[model samples]
Target: MKKQTKKGAAASRDERRMQQVFHALSAPPRRAILKYLAASSLTAGEISSRFDMAKPSVSQHLTILKTAGLVSRDKRGQYVHYALVKQTVETALMGLLTDLGAMPPAAEDKPLAEQDPSSPTAGRARKSGVATETDLPPAEKPAPAQMSMF
Candidate 1:
């Protein structure tokens, strides 16, 4: 049926996105970049200055992150500011866990925004009215080195 075909196509797209997210997170530099962006959005130069690697290397990592839907880039004048796309990362991880049977499947009857108010999806739906981390000034202090991924 046409409906089944559409569902299959969507599933294939999701699978590809999951693969991209896992691949982007596989690199140490990319992980570090995520940590930095977690604190605040930063320009490519700002991110590169924090690492010993050249700007092009950092840019390459950024490109991968962008392609993976892990990060978003906003061009402000001559500089491009990069910020973490938390929802995409969270969704990918949750989907992976669900696939691996590490977590139960989410309720599919209700749209995410209409589900639990405390859920990430609901939070994102309310983002326009909320003051998120990206709305704050860039943190001068680095992300705590001891922060755990889990």
Candidate 2:
């Protein structure tokens, strides 16, 4: 049926878009760039200065991000400024979470740790009586070695 064909076409387009977004997100540098842009827009030179990578490499990552609709570039006189397109990134992430049946809980709903006992935080909660806010475990110091003069 024509309806089925149209639906299939739309799905294919969506799949391609998802692939592009994920591919752009696959690299650590690219993710870091996104994090920087999330705070504020910056010129390409400013972005390159934040990392040790070559300018060309940063530019390539920016190109991929632009293609994925995660970022946009605007020309301010001679400089080109890059900024995060938050809506597009958020939509892709939210769609993926919905597909996985793990969309984050609404404020009115039970928190994720409480709702899913198998979650990592759930186990920690059981052991400690509540989930700890810190991401890292407490560090222990090494004992000092005793020194003796021969």
Candidate 3:
């Protein structure tokens, strides 16, 4: 349940919303388009002309961004105008990172046990030569069990 306060209810991440933002930003061309929009909204053709890539590819990128809700498309006469929906992009990334504890508080206090028991990361910690708080014991090969037939 979400809590309500004087400043209106706090916003929470919706996975679908994140999927939209991440999918849109996954392509380099789409990120470039967003940067361009941050400067000023541009028509589809205007953005298309800036890139050496074929216009259809650019259109496909634009379509993805539009689907993700990171970009809004408006039909202006015969042309389509695209603009960044900044809030959605910023919110999605920050929310994802925060939830994953990539940033502060929880990140700083994370328990070493959270790491996968079988991951090579343990070797990195030891090879770093810097003593780690993790201090995982070196893995030992278990004795092979002999099969007994009755």
Candidate 4:
């Protein structure tokens, strides 16, 4: 049926979009670019100045991000300004999490940081006899082991 074909085509598009998003996120430079754009839109040169790499490399990263729908570009005069597409990135990531059934239950009304420390769920690991960092007294806390450079 035409409906089934359309559904298949839509699914294919979604799959490609997800792949692009994940690929864009896999690179450290691209992630850094996204973080910079998150604060405010900046010209391509401004973004390139933040990193030690060549401008063309930064531009390539930006191009990949734009293709992934994670960033938008606007040309003003001779400069191209880049901005993060927060909603698109969030939607793509949340979609992947939903598809994998990894999304947290909606019943969690508050984030972990906002939850009361005395609440039943707050220290479930400690309650189960698992020794977390906070459970150890100051004197009894184990020092971090250092690795040898040799």
Candidate 5:
């Protein structure tokens, strides 16, 4: 086995941390907690109050968020205030978007249709007087059939 260098160890840790962040973000409750923390720091109780779930449940979600490095907690005498690690979340999200090629090109670049007519997306543009699915009315449901017991 090769010896692990400090940089290698750090990279491994970072990869694990990113995995944890993705896992933590997978749940709706945890995402909601992150959204709340994004606006302002709140105590566990304050955070719990926003959801219908039990305080412990909310706390569990907060714990996951905290473990992912997406949130940070500060103790102030009696209460522990939780806040979003905005930079980390933003960095992770931007990296994901970049990886997925979801970011639009700069203004200097032409639109896909204009740049390449042979591209599949270029030919998909709606022609004039065409009735697409959205233009049609909703289909009506049929009436239930009468049942007779013999």
Candidate 6:
């Protein structure tokens, strides 16, 4: 029981971390900025050229990205050059995906649901009151003749 409590606490901490990572990524402009940095570093002007948004609005997106540690900015001459922090971004996203039930899914040790074969399509299938993936029929391959008919 004590070990279970500790495990629960650890899981909660991990969930919170994953939430922060995903929350940072949920914004559209910030995602676009990351895409622009994928090829190479770009100046604020270069990034702005791709969108109709004002420079200051784009700058706000950059600030959000920096807060998430997804980008790094260097002042070169009169322009600030922004570059992708690829490793950090990838690590954070992958970590979040792993933490949110990807580590060990319901794939193992779960009892399968019982299904009624007489039920109509999209009918609920259950086994011991639980649904299993097999409740659905396998996908139908289109007939070659039918393909030609279309």
CA lDDT of 17 in candidate 3?
Answer: 64
Per-candidate Cα lDDT values, in order, are 0.81, 0.80, 0.73, 0.79, 0.73, 0.69
Candidate 1 lDDT, 49-130, residue by residue in tens: 9999989999999999999999999999999999999878767766776678876566333333434666444556555643
Off-target runs (Cα >4 Å) in candidate 6 are 1-20, 104-150
**Local accuracy of candidate 6 as per-residue lDDT tens digits, 49-72:** 999899999988888778667889
Could you tell me every candidate's TM-score relative to the true structure? 0.71, 0.65, 0.58, 0.66, 0.63, 0.55
Which candidate leads the pack in TM-score? 1
Better of 1 and 3 by lDDT: 1
Q: Which digits, one per residue and each the tens of the lDDT, describe model 4 over residues 1-150?
A: 445588899989989998999999999999999999989999999999999999999999999999999999999999899999876776776676667777664523333322356644456543543334565456767888999999
Misplaced by over 4 Å in model 4 are: 1-4, 104-150
What is the Å distance of residue 113 in model 1 from its true position? 11
Model 5 / residue 141 / CA error / Å? 45
lDDT by residue (1-150, candidate 3, tens digit) is: 866674453233356667778888888888999999988889988999899999999999988888888889888899888999866765676567677878554432233333343655555653553325345455644545899897
Which candidate should be chosen as best, given lDDT against the real structure?
1
Tell me the tens digit of each residue's lDDT in model 5 across 53-128. Answer: 9998888888888888999999999999999987577556655665577854341133323334453334443232
Candidate 6 global Cα RMSD: 13.0
Between candidates 4 and 5, the one scoring higher on TM-score is 4
Task: Give the distance in Å from residue 131's predicted Cα in candidate 1 to where it truly belongs.
Answer: 13
In terms of lDDT, which candidate is stronger, 1 or 2? 1
Model 4 clashing residue pairs (backbone): none
How much is 112 displaced in model 3, in angstroms? 30
- Candidate with better TM-score, 3 vs 6: 3
Q: Write the per-residue lDDT of candidate 2 for residues 60-104, one digit (tens) a residue.
A: 999999999999999999999999987677668767776777775
